[model samples]
Target: MLPRARPTRVVRMPDTSRLDGMTSTVTTPSSESVPRSHPADRTGAQVAADAAAVIGSADLSEAGLRRFLHGLPGVDRVGADGRAAHLGTRSIKTTAKAWALDLTISMVDLTTLEGADTPGKVRSLVAKARTPEPGDPTCPRPAAVCVYGDMVAEARDAVGNSGIRVAAVATAFPSGRAGRQVRLADTRDAVAAGADEIDMVIDRGAFLSGGFRKVYDDIVAVREVCHDAEHPAHLKVILETGELATYDNVRRASWLAMLAGADFIKTSTGKVSPAATLPVTVIMLEAVRDFLATTGVQVGVKPAGGIRTAKDAIKYLVSVNEVAGEPWLDPDYFRFGASSLLNDVLLQRQKLATGAYSGPDYVTID
Candidate 1:
């Protein structure tokens, strides 16, 4: 069993009185409780130095990484489940529901990563991303169009100045089984092809085997690739928490990725069972929250995979508000990596506007 941290109280429910008006009052941890280093404005090298400084080790050896990770606080499984279940039940009024529906649409990554993905299919997906509801101009476009690395140019061409980013999955996505050079090349190719963001999967096998330094080095290498790209694409590290086997591993992996300079720490690759759950997401949110409190560098959290409904998305929004605070409420700080979730959000948005639920055929088939 992993070492457990001192038990702390579960996160409190956020004040939601302003949700109906599209504003929220969330309570953040006081600066005195967690010292801030203001590392966000620093260069990558400075951020890396800051991470090393925080860990109290300049050399990130395997033993050093292991000691630091194990020495961190442990999670209370029962308390986490209870808090997640409690947050999921928060009621959303009509106006707030409408706002959430729109916000969910805008935060979607609008993905399609099948083995048989073609340019035409990617173009179609981009079309839906640009205008989810064709007739209604009020419909907000998705945050980005996510596709396989090879399809980055197609997605980029299709998105074309719509303000929607083009994210590509690289570093042997879904399974980080390739060699380091191959993974780096894969990332370079995607960025060269005009990808605005690169979603790289971590080596779950390495992590499970206690190769903490290997995992950290892998993310650092990928982060360097993203940083060196001509357009400087954002790097989202996919932890594939399903294979991690424990909440403790999830927290460690989250910190490892952030320390290695990942712009975002994602939950899964959407290729595994139990892809994204409230409890798991809550753990990740808490990691980012505490990380921000410590380093003053806010990292984004993306819970990909099984999220597929307007109500479910709203539940996640509530969790974001309550767990990580209001800073993560924007699309830049949070995202839903789903292909089918967009259609559901659109259906709910229509129902709110017309007072009647639209059929599945009303939206384009993703």
Candidate 2:
């Protein structure tokens, strides 16, 4: 028999004064706090300038990126794991749980990236993204609907002006094995197809083989494609941390992507084992926090794969608050690249509202 649900602790909203240039706030449990819109887009040249400013007089050569990445503070694996485990134990009850459930739903990037994906499947995902809870008008929509480059147009048309973004994976995705020209074309196609955001996978092989400059150039190239687009899509650099093999490497990759002008640094492609572990995410959170402090540039973080339950999502929220501060709590700065996670969050949200669990049938099976 399943154990009865227990009350969880509330995550207190952090002070907004530390949010820097972020004008939007997410305080109350209401959906108003969920970010449904984004700030004006910047051009590719502007983004490059920002990256240059962060680089300062430092070397812009391959050796320079290598030196900088290797120079990042090494992550204490034991300490990170301990901190994440400790935070995971935090429990919230009633109102706080309700708020967290809503926030979790809002942060999701409902994704469907598969060989079997069809236009119909993408449309269903968009519908779910628009209204996660069928009858609850109060339910906040997800931050975005993530799909492949070819399906961007379908997603874009379906989403319309609902304020839900359409994010497409590009730069050859998953393996990122294509050449530079092919990868650039992939990004251009997605942007032209009206994707609001581009999630590009880094060359894990190049990164692991000490080809730091290659990886850096790959991200920079993709970022340029996003910014140069007429719509100026946001660029999310996926580090594929599961293959990165170490906590220290995760930190390096996070900083590397940020310095390369990644609007968001993602953890995985969801095609590998041990994807999106708390410790790896903690390292990433720390990297982004430190990057903001040093460069005055705020970047988002997305942990994809294996985060299916509302419980797991809440733990990540706690880590984001404790490590990166409250600024990241909003959907604008944090996202979950998940497909199954939304349905699970809906189930939990229903349970919290009605005091009774709704089985799997209550939510779509996408």
Candidate 3:
């Protein structure tokens, strides 16, 4: 039987009592009260101009690594897993557009969303989700249709009975430049309108501008808005790794986000030039691993944007399995925030199962 769609509800913030034992305190970012250890605090437009002055400038030795790693609740370094050789076969077979997608593409003004060629582009994307043409063999079904605040109800209505999730980018998406009350209100509104998961963009600007405290406080406030029991929408925090730059910086962002109550730590906003890449994902996964060990809180990791093939997804899977150990392999712990790449994964799955390559409709993710 197909999994029944979990109904969306009005999400309430976690109780203050639950906050008693948590490791880190979420703080608002400012010049005076910056977050404790996130290196993203060092990146900004002006700083990027001084790349030559920044490259390999900071100490990244083993001691530096241990200092950051040991701060998390449950972090420990594993020598090497003998299962490292199993990194190659990471593909999932399905059609690209038919499966699911987290339409949380916040890098641009989605209100001016391009490619809405048909009358109901969002509806069409929802309707055509289960159908495919003969010639389109490489596409895979998107996991969900992600959208921002206002469209949650529309997306929910469009995807009715399809058993697909309608995710909304919330907590002041993209820029996350809103005030705390506004951000929390946005999250509450999205959930009430039937959004399944909340994809939040971290305040990269604040984190990069020596305002980690603000960034942390923002995430906690947003998280509070969505922590209800019945309609519990998971939170995915986008780090905008491209803007942050450097593997070490990515690692620090991951730790900070995970510590700040993010259920999943994601890579980019798709608007940024660098987007999601290999090294950034590696760092994020390792951060998740260490955080899980320390705090015993197993958060998820998502690599969004710029992924387009089965091979790419497989590499990410390999990286997760390699760096994070075997326990983090499930979709609950890992997700791909992609729209263009699911088809290639499906095509490859078709070839592996059937001797001959087939068209898009040949496979179904359900």
TM-score of each: 0.90, 0.87, 0.65
Model 3 alpha-carbon drift over 4 Å, by segment: 1-119, 128-142, 358-366
Tens digits of per-residue lDDT, candidate 3, 6-68, equal: 212121222222111121232212223221222122222212222111121222233333344
Model 1 Cα lDDT, one tens digit per residue, 134-228:
88998899999899999999999999989999999999998999999999999999999999889999999999999988998898888888887
Clashing pairs in 2: 8-91, 8-92, 8-93, 9-91, 9-92
**In model 1, how large is the Cα lDDT of residue 295?**
66
Pairwise TM-score winner, candidates 1 and 3: 1
| CA shift of 52, model 2, Å | 5.1
* Residue runs of model 1 more than 4 Å from their true location after superposition: 1-27, 30-42
TM-score-sorted candidate list, best first: 1, 2, 3
Q: Taking the tens digit of each residue's C-alpha lDDT, what string does model 2 give over 1-366?
A: 333222121112223233221211323222243322222244445444544445442335677667666765566676667777887989977898899989998999999999899999999999988878888999999999999999999999999999999999998888999999999999999999999999999999998888887888888788888887688899899999999998878877887788788889999999888889887887787776656555455789999999999899999998888777778898989999898888888998889888998999888787
lDDT per model vs. reference: 0.83, 0.80, 0.57
Alpha carbon lDDT at 149, candidate 1:
95
Q: What RMSD does each model have against the real structure?
A: 6.9, 10.9, 14.5
Candidate 2: stretches off by over 4 Å: 1-57
